[model samples]
Target: MQKPEPMKDQVPWATIGLVLLWYGTNIGVLLLNKYLLSNYGFKYPVFLTMCHMTACSLLSYAAIAFMKVVPMQSIKSKRQFLKISALSAVFCFSVVLGNVSLRFLPVSFNQAIGATTPFFTAVFAYLMSNKREAWLTYATLVPVVAGVIIASRSEPSFHLFGFIMCVSATAARAFKSVLQGILLSSEGEKLNSMNLLMYMAPIAVVILLPATLLMEENVIGNTIALARNDIKIVWYLLFNSSLAYFVNLTNFLVTKRTSALTLQVLGNAKGAVAVVVSILIFKNPVSIIGMIGYLFTVMGVVLYSEAKKRYG
Candidate 1:
């Protein structure tokens, strides 16, 4: 008898464990960063991002050299370096803008706004690929974008700068996903996720250092205050950095092992989880319309993913 074909979306228990790890660590980093920047009063998103990049760079190197967690892949030429540099810049912008928005908005509001990422992703995917999606797919994003607009207008803690940065970050994230996939698939220049991270993290360091210096002031003074207030902030920041690494790692692992839609579904679920946990932890005031809009946005993500699964 012939063996049955393997299911593309079948997820083993091990993969589920990684998904849970991804969820926990993601929430941990968001909450920890918010605490440090807001209540803990660190107030340096660029500097904080620079630190995470530095940590990930050093740790990525160590993993390759010492632990052999990922085999090393040399950047073969300047063209490859330039490609990696561009990817790194887009990645940096997405993350740093996210970190910056925390200073001006509550975590719940930030995440509700963030749930509209699929809208941006859909828009960029069409523009770059020039592939027209099914009108049903396009219709799915309408509510997602509308919901975010409603939430933004209704959020009690909304700041114009934060709102703008968050929206831009969402678009950058969407663009990066599309561009990174294209860049990695280039002829004779494929890199696995870990190798990509290894190369990209250093470029991020170079890019972020100048931005941090230009955008933030009195880092040394703030560091002293943060440390003196609670040395535990330092410890949590280290943990946050480490989680950032694992988040990237598990993301790659999840994609390689499961169906494409699995990750996107989990991504939508993560946005919902982040919004709920943010509300509980931060106790931020959200208007009724904002809650309604948040739910609409999340539902739109689910419907959009399902629509793609069926038709796209």
Candidate 2:
């Protein structure tokens, strides 16, 4: 008798465990990033992102080289490569924006707002796939928006520019999620999430280099100078960046192994963890409204997750 064909959409229990681990690892990444930025400065965040991406890119390159899995010749079309590269670049930008926000905002608030990515992603997915969404999904939007407003109360330096940037950053992140889902669904190649991430760093560096030079204090020269004076900062940046990538890669794997639903449930802890880290490390002030906001945000995430499970 022939073996039964594996169901592509079936989720496994091991993936559930992985998703939980991903949540824990992400919390660690948040702690490290918040600690570094609040204690140090933007230079730390910049260096961390650049260096971490460099390391991950190198590791990914090494793996591909050893397996002799050079960009699959079939998918080596310039147009395809450019498309993937563009997606990766956008991801990198979203990441950098989040990092920059960490410098000014509390981790809890940042992540609380960031969590809205799923909602935006749902909308994008609906638009991209041209599928109609269920009423339940739309219903959850009210809580999600309210939660964002609540969480915004604790923002350390809430300016119009910063608020706009943070919102844009969250939306961009949502876009990345939608794009990745589309890519992974359509692409037939052996492209793992890590592979996608590995391609991102180099492309991101290329895209952000000009901005770093013009907007950042002194770019490479300043970073180099700072590194020379404080080697600890280098280590901090390296560790934070590396951990962040690892967390993300782990998340993708976990979601693949388990159902996205499991990860969503487990990921609800990120905001609380982020909040504690911000309070303890940064001594960020929180008002009654902010606490309410956090609860609402968490509720929105839960509601959104359930809606997807039912309607997705």
lDDT of 1 by residue, 134-219 (tens): 99999999889888888877888889998898888888988998887777676579888788899899899999888987888878
Model 2 CA RMSD to the hidden true structure, in angstroms: 6.0
Off by over 4 Å in 1: 1-12
lDDT of 1: 0.85
Note the Cα lDDT for every prediction shown.
0.85, 0.70
Instruction: Estimate candidate 1's RMSD in Å.
Output: 4.0
Please provide TM-scores, in order, for all candidate models, with all chains considered together.
Answer: 0.90, 0.82
Cα error, residue 67 of model 1, in Å, equals 3.6
Model 1 residue 86 lDDT? Answer: 96
C-alpha positional error of residue 45 in candidate 2 after TM-score superposition, expressed in Å = 4.7
